[model samples]
Target: MSLLVTLAASTEELAPLLMPPLAFAGIAAAIFIALGFVVFSFRDVANRQGQGAGKSSDTHGSGH
Candidate 1:
């Protein structure tokens, strides 16, 4: 019981020092993943075609 109490106290004392960096890393990862999704969505749009004859929109009228 004494060891558990001491461990809890030590963890409490270190939590403040440890939490901010861990939180920032999680937020940064979320932002990076979101940005990647946005970029991929845009790329998909840019390379997309309308109603199909099997050609990309970007090559519609630029003389092949």
Candidate 2:
């Protein structure tokens, strides 16, 4: 009974420090995901630039 009481007391004191580590991990994960999306989008933009498809829309007005 005494051990349970002590353990519960420690847990209450440690909760604030514990939650911030989890929060930091979550924030780091979000930053990683954002960077991955930026790299992927830039890669695709570069691929589009190489395909010569960017001018098709500009010439569409002449067809009308």
Candidate 3:
């Protein structure tokens, strides 16, 4: 019932939760979610600009 025993037991119970594979999986999931957000935002902006259907600006300063 000492402090050391309690801490040790807590750590033992929590050790598997911080293992490397689980940590990597969490990081990968986070990155994928972030990428999805970025892509979604880009598509939204393109749609708002009326360029969502593959149209692009071609009006360069050619002075023709």
Candidate 4:
């Protein structure tokens, strides 16, 4: 039938991926690793501030 022919023609016109399917997973993993490094870099940030590195002690108040 003509309908079967049209369906077969449409199925053949599929789009191609810009990259392989596994490459997409690799890209996402790389992004997460980079973000993990960024977060790790700030690991001791709070401790640095508590050490009187830059902030003045009296900023919170003299009551302590």
Candidate 5:
């Protein structure tokens, strides 16, 4: 009887460890979606160099 009770208690305790797979999968899917967004938004555009202080292409000293 004691062994049966201990087995039943152990089984009951282990029930939770078997659950939460779907929760983990959902979190994984969200992380994957965020990573996809970052990978898709990355681009390399030429002729887009930064213009620092006192740099201009127009006439007059308008860049100062």
Candidate 6:
């Protein structure tokens, strides 16, 4: 019982957060959104290479 009381008291005396808990979540959300934009920017890249870009006389059989 005494050990439990001591542990609770120690936990209550710990240092405060540098930022609010919500701020940490917001920072993580912003980073994910930025990365999402980066991935979105690469959309349809294969189609932009023009027709017949992958075809060649040396290749054979469905290309795969």
List the candidate 2 regions with Cα displacement exceeding 4 Å: 1-19, 45-64
lDDT of 2 by residue, 20-58 (tens): 677989999999999999887777776777566657756
Cα RMSD of all models vs. native, in order, equals 7.8, 8.4, 9.0, 3.9, 6.8, 4.2
Using TM-score as the measure, which candidate wins?
4
User: How well does each candidate superpose onto the true structure, as a TM-score?
Assistant: 0.41, 0.42, 0.41, 0.64, 0.41, 0.60
Ranking by TM-score: 4, 6, 2, 3, 1, 5
- Candidate 5, 1-64: lDDT as tens digits: 9999887778444355544889889889999999998876664322244443224554455653
Order candidates by lDDT, high to low. Answer: 4, 6, 2, 1, 3, 5
- Tens digit of lDDT per residue, candidate 1, span 1-64? 9999887778444344645787989989999999999887787554454435446555677564
lDDT of 4 at 24: 100
Against the true structure, candidate 2 has what lDDT?
Answer: 0.76
lDDT of candidate 4 at residue 8, scale 0 to 100? 75
Candidate scoring better on lDDT of 4 and 5: 4
Give the best candidate by lDDT. 4
* Residue 18 in model 2: lDDT: 50
Error of 4 at 47 (Å): 1.4
Residue 55 lDDT (model 2): 79
**lDDT agreement with native, every candidate:** 0.72, 0.76, 0.71, 0.86, 0.66, 0.80
lDDT tens string, model 3, 1-64?
6998887767444345556787899999999999999887787675567763333444543433
Model 5: weakest 10-residue lDDT segment is: 45-54
lDDT by residue (1-64, candidate 4, tens digit) is 9999898778565699999999999999999999999999999999988888435767766565
lDDT digits (tens) for residues 1-64 of candidate 6: 9999898778565589999999999999999999999999998786766444556533655645
